[model samples]
Target: MRLLLASLILLVFIPLNAQTTRKYSNEFMNIGVDAAALGQSNAVVARSNDVNAGYWNPAGLINLEDNQLALMHSSYFANIANYDYAGFAMPLDDNSAFGVSLIRFAVDDILDTTQLIDEQGNVNYDRISLFSTADYGLTVSYSRNLPIQGLSYGVNAKIIRRIIGDFASSWGVGLDAAIQFETDNNWKFGVMARDITTTYNSWSINEEEFAKVQNAVEGQNQELPETTEITIPKLQIGVAKLYRFHYDYTLEAEIDLNVRFEQNNDVISTSFASINPAFGFEFGYIDMIYLRGGMGNFQNELQIDNSEQLTFQPTFGVGFKYNGIQVDYAFTDIGDQSVALYSNVFSLKLDFSIFR
Candidate 1:
């Protein structure tokens, strides 16, 4: 465990050549996957004990009790954008696990108006066309025991793909490392390092499409766009605990500190890094029916007088489990940004042991 921790630290802090950190580059992946997580403002790092762990905290995958499959779908901005996810995970043995996850977010049916004014400047509605832009993430993860009871480590290999109809596309790769530890008292702690090695995306633009758009307007498309994008490393630290009101009633609460290496709108602002804290809890009756809620994304908004006032996003959700199948729902904000649109998210999980 000591060696593993040391290596992860080294990788996270190591300097890279030509580092190009940008705000919200490949940001779609951060929108989150499962609805249970979205409800808690993505604070499930410490207790994600199922297939969904592949994205939250891979180390938690070690806690899975059976082979599992998961699926989710969500829409944002009045259904203009759609997000989808799918994952599969299974325990390889008593001390190890493996999982794979795929996520996609897209905006479709966008009108292309470049050719609207044909050669003679005639108003031709028939020239209008449609296109779509999408972003995708694929992650393969592995978790293993750390030779210490209740302690485990995990790693993820990721592939990122972005597309804009036939005009442009990009491909990138990155890595993540995480750890989770549980105590006998039902206290769980976890840390996840996202894009720990710095992710890079190289884009290819279609000159044919560029020419059409450039000629559409005299003053536009004057220069070639930057084809490279970079995503800096981020960290999430979480702690959670479970309490029982009785033999059949229970509650679990979790708190997470999400950190980004660059300053942003987080309430805890700093030039080096900013921190956002999220709190969430779940109440369960026999672990079959559940209710969840949370609040997060605190920000200091500048008012008319330049004075800052605090604001936060609130979320709610409900879940049900029966016969090895579980369904969850959440009404929450899209990403950590204080977007007013609260999207509805749904996810399904199935345990393969039911077949036995």
Candidate 2:
């Protein structure tokens, strides 16, 4: 009971110190994968138990009893962008495990208008071209059970790459660590430190092309500059509980709170107004079929006058498992009024130990 009380206190107190800011970089890394987790509004820090744990909370990988592989694909942001993830986990022993995952988010075939005009100020249709923008990350993760019962820890080392067609590219490396505790009475707590190394992306531009472009518009007051970006650290805390009923039915509820520390106007500080919280619920029958719903991005709107804030978004998902294989689907609202606001995600997971 004391643990429950502590969890409640944390949920309420953490966001009070959150302040809003917009100086952080690498926003694409914040896009979550896994249909099941997304369906639950990404409140999986304490509830992740499958291969997807490598991306959500690596410590959760300790709960897996078998080797597993999972893949996910989604049509994001007005259905014009593609986001995909793949993860695999292998248990080394009863107390340790290793995992790896890859993520790619891309927008393809975007029209390049920079070179569409000729020197005579006439539009050259033949000069029009297409290019792509992509972000990729490869993560290697490890997890192990601690000497203390019900406690576990994990870490993920990641290599990140971003490309703007062939014009510019950047590379970065980062680390993430997580710890989780599950009590005997079905309560779970999790904390994760993301980008512990303050991932830095050093960009390199094509100099010859860049100079020509600079000379092309020398008097027009337009210029492109190469710069480095740093991804600030984000901390996440989560709590969850599960209940089981007769006939193999189970229900679960989870909540996650996030805080980001970054340089706001050249001074490093925590943005108290940027505190985001997510909530999720799941129902399952005999571990075969599952239903989930959640809400996310609640920016501490506790007052009545601020009831119409746009921070909250609804998410839903469903899953089916049979013969060691699971397929899941999720739908998310991207916070827009148009039909494009809705995005669809699909995922498949395979457990290989079941066959062996």
Query: For this target, which candidate reaches the highest lDDT against the unseen true structure?
Result: 1
RMSD of 1: 8.7
User: All candidates' TM-scores?
Assistant: 0.92, 0.85
lDDT of 2 by residue, 199-234 (tens): 887777676555544454446433444356678888
Candidate closest to the true structure, highest TM-score: 1
lDDT of each: 0.86, 0.80
**How well is each residue in 151-211 modelled by candidate 1, as lDDT tens digits?**
9999999999998767778899999999999999999999999999889888787878857
Alpha-carbon lDDT of model 2: 0.80
Q: Which residue pairs come into collision in candidate 1?
A: none
* List of clashing residue pairs for candidate 2: 17-272, 18-271, 18-272, 18-273, 19-271, 19-272, 19-273, 19-274, 20-273
Candidate 2 segments whose C-alpha is farther than 4 A from its true place: 1-23, 211-219, 262-273, 300-310, 336-340
